[model samples]
Target: MKNNFFYGYSKQADLPEKKRLLFTEFMKNNVKINQADSATLLTGVLAPPAAMAAKKAGESLPQLKMIKNVPDVLFVPSATVVALITVRFSKRLFMRN
Candidate 1:
């Protein structure tokens, strides 16, 4: 159990059920986003399985709303892919000047 990825969370049986469910739901929804360092700053590192357990326990996790992609020229080479990406860069450029 100690070796589990969510050992700390699993051991948190003393936590209030509502708070625990929220944490778990947060994890389940943001698991992929939290993989990035920047995303971690925004989201957090939570345990998805813990959230699943909460769901199984009859707690409903609210839908997690996360941006589909972060508009960075480095990751998105083509500015045409998303007009927002171009707009974002333009805003930055204008601000810098």
Candidate 2:
């Protein structure tokens, strides 16, 4: 029960690195920010590389999307933690900008 709850919660803050990379890459190629227009709002888990790329490209991503990132019993602990932090901090930075 606890594990399930944590898994659900974590999905809101983290995503698989490959998915993050692809989502941000797609946005980078498609989103354009103009001063007169409000920036597009995206909610998704963003890894460090994806966030940095989006930042440099002037894209706005608000938070981690509620995407599934299932944690294996013994394999995904550390990566999940890092991804959570990356997504949160990146969202903060994007919001600030």
Candidate 1 residue-wise lDDT, 1-97, digit = tens? 2334365566766787855786777678668752333423222223233333433443332452222233333323332333344445665688799
lDDT of 1: 0.45
lDDT values of the candidates?
0.45, 0.47
The 10-residue segment with the lowest total lDDT in model 2? 35-44
Candidate 2 residue-wise lDDT, 1-97, digit = tens: 3334344445646557755665566678778985321222222233334544534444333353321232233224444455565556776798899
